[model samples]
Target: MMMMMQQLQESPVQKNSLFNAMDRFIGAVNNMDQTVMVPSLLRDVPLDEDTEMSSLKSGSDDEESDMYSYYQLLKSIRVDIEWGVRRAAADERLQQQESHKTLSRRGSSASTSSYASSSMSLSEEEDSEDEDLQKQFQYHLTGLQGVLSKLTVQADSLTKRYKKEVGIGA
Candidate 1:
């Protein structure tokens, strides 16, 4: 029982498992899907001997080392979320710009087709295509917004967990 307890307390299996889980979490966060459920990223905090060893070499305390690890992880997560948010916002802006250009082109085409009755059918087809494009763009924008919301929630949860672990608040 003592041997088992020791193994459980400081096992390579646990560390490797945690690393694999963290990698998967990072990958899923990078390629987010609104339709799929986001996996819980938080795991039971293991006493990280590796971090402690490195910190010992640098003459830092245990608490400082743990806090440093948490800070780095949180920083990385924040950067990734920010990047995803920025990308989605940029995509939405580009879509809006394209929609505006399409509208302007349609306006000009309508004015010219006023005299050319034969091209009026083509203009109607273009309008239908524009509407379809707009719908598709809106759908993508909504999905992105959902993804952003999920990420925000995940970040908030992580922050709360970190605070709890560090004994910051009730």
Candidate 2:
């Protein structure tokens, strides 16, 4: 059991800062008294509206000041995570496309026996390889898509729940 736990501990996914920050954010949001705090939080500064840094950093209004500070921290961390995920996804897609192109080219141009024998076997191999690569890509893509979608849904649900709890809804 200890060895299993240690192995899980050592997994790269467990060490991801994005995951850690999100976990902490969710925990903080969950623990907050949404009815009391969130309405004021949402009204003072909405998620749709961008808070100016200068006003936030130097504002004298107590409510605006506190809300702006929290907003800044939350927004900054979220933006960072969003940028990282987008960049990582783009890089992965580019690599996959390049590998696919290379595979196609190699299969097409590789020297073998006669045209019929060579082409038939090569096509079969290419088809199988392509299918395998596609399956692998789909697996990773599905996992990533699921994680991102779940995060978005959770954030949105939390926001709506907070609004409802605080009687912020019209």
Candidate 3:
């Protein structure tokens, strides 16, 4: 047992495998497709109902689990926001570089009017794309904010409930 535990501790892959198994179990539970099989598998085993009741009564573990999930969602949203910002910045830089190159070429060429018109059109197209990107970012930001607010409310309520259950004044 000690050797197994030590090996598991030393192997990140083992930890990932364990988490993958847990994820699949949770997914199966959520889907309810394995409900019959689960009951049959556990038919000979006795479950600790008192422990479940005590855990539910305390509610701290549930709250922490919920908070962790919300934190992960928040992290994912932040990552998306960062990616969008970086992409927008890169697009802007690319457009500026393209415009500069066009300007330099126009100065040495005889097609000034044509180059100017093309540059204007390119700028307009880029601006439109930028606006679209901004709108998308705004939509995601608003949705994320709404979700974050809801999560905050839930966490606050959970904290209050846990406090009351433990006979602590909030």
Candidate 4:
């Protein structure tokens, strides 16, 4: 037992901010699981009318999902986070070779209008794309922050709502 304690003490510290956030997220989700014992109670409870996450379940923009679905979604997200599963965005990591081929075709075309329409060099186009990529990074970061904020609120709301439904009255 002393050896085990010393081995544990010798382990490196987890000072990374991302890891800290993940730890908090996992703890909150665990709390939610404990609070929401009877998930059937959440079946028809509607989430915020904005329906952002529900839309993701279907192609339709105005899909109606109940609190139960949201609960499952949150749990699945927690699993993904815990397992370090990362998914790429729809527009992420465009093929640079394909882009270069397309750009080269545009620049080296026989039509004068094609050349006259845009006088930007290939390097300039690449630079422009790089700038756009930077903007996209910032945009995604902002969007992620918003989504995380909403999810946090949803998690707390679910826990509270579950408690109320279960007659715990928190």
Candidate 5:
């Protein structure tokens, strides 16, 4: 009974074995065993160790030297995750823009078709009603765009802060 309740409250990440793996990877990176950590890095982060080692080493390969490649690898993964988040936000924005364009086109075609057929059967009162409905839809679409724009701004700001914390520039 206690185990069932604990399972229910566990986070998705906590429930998955991947989270355990990530914790272990972080431990290995902090431990400074580049050989052990490098394999894990290649499997997960896929960085070029030669370049990363050069950056961290500043030019010596002394076994007990202060320099370690794992910190750079950890930092690189954090940067990559931050950039991935920004890319996902940008992709969402692009999708919203396309949807807005498609809706605008749809509304315009509907108005044009309605106007063209106005002479046949739709009464003046019905025309006014349709116009009101169209206005309401346009207003809703404008509100949606405003919300998305605000969200995008917030996402950008969050990403900037994350980069700054990770010692990376926007």
Candidate 6:
């Protein structure tokens, strides 16, 4: 009986995990925004060792060590997630690509035996590529859940670190 109620509560979260993840991350950023009243105080203060280790692991834009940058990044991520900015742009690009493919296909016909055989092979390759893409998307979706949680914690940690630096509370 208890399990059924728990499952019912979790059903909506499972249905659209991305929105919930974004909501969690955005809420954390909003909390950080209120806590860190004076952002300048975070200017030169470096993030924690965990962030340093993450920078080393990711080895790209994550190389930034300053707390101020992390603060800005958290806000930026909040905006991006809240708006689905990247996803919308990517969807537009994909639509354009699909339209182009449709136009090109309409201009051609596989009347020849050789062309028909090659088209069949190309379709098989496309199927395999689609499967690969699906796998990658699923993997990224799983990663997105963990990453959202981590970013929420990072936001909280930053707020706490800022408070400590400002001698507000320990």
Indicate whether candidate 3 or candidate 6 has the larger lDDT: 6
Q: In model 3, which runs have C-alpha deviations exceeding 4 angstroms?
A: 1-120
Candidate 5 off by > 4 Å: 1-122
Question: Tens digits of per-residue lDDT for model 1 on 39-80?
Answer: 233233432433322323254444543433443454466465
Model 3: lDDT of residue 102:
94
Best by TM-score: 6
By TM-score, how accurate is candidate 1? 0.34
RMSD (Å) of each candidate, 1 decimal: 17.1, 12.8, 17.5, 8.1, 16.5, 5.8
**lDDT per model vs. reference:** 0.53, 0.55, 0.47, 0.69, 0.48, 0.78
lDDT tens readout by residue for model 4, 1-170? 99999767755543323455556666767899998988888887666543344444463223436778778878888987777554553234346657888988787685556644877887898999999999999887667655655666667767877787778975
Return the number of clashes found in candidate 6: 0
- lDDT tens digits, residue span 1-170, model 3: 99999887878765334344334333432333222222233222221232322332243444333323333333344454444546777799999999998987778575555645565687787899799999999887666555444433433443343344345565
Q: Which stretches of candidate 2 lie over 4 Å from their true place?
A: 1-81, 85-130
Ranking by TM-score: 6, 4, 1, 3, 2, 5
In angstroms, what RMSD does candidate 1 have relative to the true structure? 17.1
Global local distance difference test of model 4? 0.69
**TM-score of each model, in listed order:** 0.34, 0.30, 0.31, 0.58, 0.28, 0.64
Give the winner by TM-score: 1 or 3: 1
- Per-residue lDDT for 77 in model 1? 64
Q: Which segments of model 4 are wrong by more than 4 Å?
A: 1-25, 48-64, 84-118
Q: Model 2 Cα RMSD, Å?
A: 12.8
Candidate 6: regions farther than 4 A off: 1-16, 48-64, 86-115, 119-130
Clashes of 4: 0
User: 16, model 3: CA deviation in Å?
Assistant: 39
Candidate 1, residue 135: how far the Cα is off, in Å: 0.4
Residue 83 lDDT, candidate 2, scale 0-100 = 57
Predicted candidate 2 versus true structure: per-residue lDDT over 46-165, tens digit per residue: 332323323333534555444434534444445655555467777999999999999977876676444676535777878998999999998876675555444444344445545654
lDDT, residue 139, model 1: 86
Better of 5 and 6 by TM-score: 6
Candidate 1 stretches with Cα past 4 Å from truth are 1-120
